[model samples]
Target: MPDSAPPPEFGEASHEPTEALEPSAADLSRTRTEEAVPHTAIIVPILARGVTLGVTTFFRSRRDEAFDEDDLRLAEELVARAAVCLDNARRYTRERAAALVLQRSLLPHGVPPQEAVEAASFYRPADELSGLGGDWFDVIPLSGARVALVVGEVLGHGIEAAATMGQLRTAVRTLADLDLSPEELLAHLDDLVIQVTQEGHEADPGGVSGPGAVGASCLYAVYDPVGLRCELASAGHLAPAVVTPDGTVAFPDLPPGPALGLGGLPFESVDLPLEEGSVLAFYTDGLIAAPGAGKEGLRRALTERELPLDQLCRRIVDELAPSRPYTDDAALLMVRTRRLAASHVAAWDLPADPAVVARARLMAARQLGTWGLEELAFTTELVVSELVTNAIRHAAGPIRLRLILERTLICEVFDASSTSPHLRHARTTDEGGRGLFLISQFTRRWGTRYTAEGKVIWAEQPLDPDDTPARTSGD
Candidate 1:
């Protein structure tokens, strides 16, 4: 039989090698086997959506009998069924490829180096036939040598889940920058998920709706290097595994609220004091919940305390799921806590008197010089004076000034009052409004955060290289 023939609607082409086929010698040669032995054959072209994919061939020895009308009809029916199946498979393959691409693009490419916590992550999408699912993790660097570790999963598979994941991840970064507490961040995230689900339904009534729509779980945590503390919150997600420096594993008690978009209840945050060198792990349920892998396996995988984080991740992947293709999307983020030493931080109490501003400035200059940050002395001294003066004037007595030397020179003023500071442009006639304004000009950035006891107004100035000379002078 010929591999392909003219459309049956146009009058099908059939060949009996015992007879000469039209289109002459070439047609006969193509339809004939290399042996050129006489034979009778029926060739049926397989068509999909009006395009010819290939052909189905049925050959019979010429001596037996030529193909009858009944036989031809049967061959046509078989090829018709095969064509539809092939077309569907091709479409599915294309769609899956696209979904996987979208999912990968939505995930973080790499974890940025953080001084507070060393982070490493691993992610694997489900096998192709299973479709792509939404699984994502992030390491967001926050102000004051703090980092936010996140892992989230959208409920179902394919492009919709991946898209929803991207939306949630973006919302997290934005909220994290606002310095929202863990519980507060999740609350805002829940609101966003509700908004997304509503908008998705309104925009596409038949698309992206139903049970799995907008259902997701997230584990959000913020780590502070100076305090060696982690504030964690979860939204119907798995509890994290914490490995102490001595390799003892423990899972902290944290409230896991209902999955986002479903729970209107307020999320609660837990404060965990992470010991120095403790390893904290955040992951989607797939890693531990997959068949044949249990929480025990996760603990065992993490118990290899001697391994570096990257190797530890590989070890976990190999031990937990050695299969080539994962059945569900899996993501794991491991962070090792590193505390800041006293040598890097300096704090002192300041009197509420104006005369003490010079003393604060002098202390700041001496500390900056000790840290090989003389280039920042002239600028940092003015910043300390302003922040302390403001705290003494606008806030209460027993004010405190703290200096932390990390990637930047952080000058903070702590007071007994909860009043937050605002930055405003000082009019030329005003002598008072310029404290914050001048501090703003000399520093890279500044902001205020409230602690349980009081509020701390902090300013950050980029630390110049040791060899670099002073960059600014007092105003």
Candidate 2:
């Protein structure tokens, strides 16, 4: 019997092998006794990524008679049509998989729990045909300032669109690390993109396609935990929602600004406040673009659900990520805003010996005691003691320490070294090399950064009483 289903438009053509129905005379007799036999049958293949994943078979009985040659021929046509549908579904799956992998690499692995606030981010590509669009998010830590944030989307789809997203996101981070204002940062990025495009044209001897790539819509924001303020710039981007504790909130308005790549235009920055017990949501258009659902649908979802920004972002996908997964690429970045009484002091050019670190720790403890944070001071001293002792044993030159009292206790150590601290399991006879591991096991989070002069090792401890009280040392 001929196979039932349409020919698939897969990259490689499919050659189906025909097989006869497997029914013995005995089985046929059983079928006859039960009712009759199938006069018509249809077979449909379930495909994914251009491959037939599974098949669904259907049959119809006529006048209680068994299926014959004519009926089998009709079934073949039905199966042919099924193949086309299956192939299309597979193609979409492939596109989504590709976009997701790329987006994951671009975003941070995951943000650790922060003080006085929570953060969550997500990214999904548009329908498979649209490929990956330019929607991105970033959170940057500033020097004695606030967390810099950005969410943006380019205006196209496909491989070119994906490339543009990558370029713009990288530029945003570079400019942010330089401590550029939102307006100034975007301006530099705008110029860089145009410059790159022009340079590409110069490099291309042969004829190339259209102008490099158009600019994108972006929301640039800065959240200061101490000041309880959020400064943002909206460039042809959607309004960000401000969710309140009572579950009643609205999207804040902002001064208009031109999208990136638009020449002869200027952009404005808007600053706002993040009150206690409030959630602020920043997302791309995909969150509002479900079929037959518009802005109202989004508004209803956010308001009625009373979900915080982080949870809201996940809800958008978990609850409404298409009945059978999305057809397009999509991405989202959300943060719950809050205020905390936090302060940090980083002093350099201090002695690198153990005694200096002891003094530094005492100094930090006194400062904390002055600030009515004696508990934090004790914890900070313990952390500094270990870090400084290690530095004294291994490196030479000056050391620095940063004491930050936020919702958590954060102590940072700076030494004239680039080699990362070691964290290893030690025996009773061993005397060293467990500082990093011990801190990691005890603190809420600990990491090292490559500073301009040397390196900075930092650790955070939560003040929450519900947290685990166990402790560990360098190993």
Q: Give the root-mean-square deviation of each candidate in angstroms.
A: 5.9, 10.8
Estimate candidate 1's alpha-carbon lDDT, on a 0 to 1 scale: 0.79
Q: Which stretches of candidate 2 lie over 4 Å from their true place?
A: 1-100, 128-131, 205-212, 290-294, 305-311, 317-329, 342-365, 368-403, 406-475
Task: Name the lDDT value of residue 248 in candidate 2.
Answer: 74
Best by TM-score: 1
lDDT of 2 at 255: 70
Q: Backbone clashes per model, in order? A: 0, 26
Q: What is the lDDT of residue 391 in candidate 2?
A: 75
Q: For model 1, give the 10-residue run with minimal summed lDDT.
A: 466-475
Write down the lDDT of every candidate, Cα atoms only: 0.79, 0.66
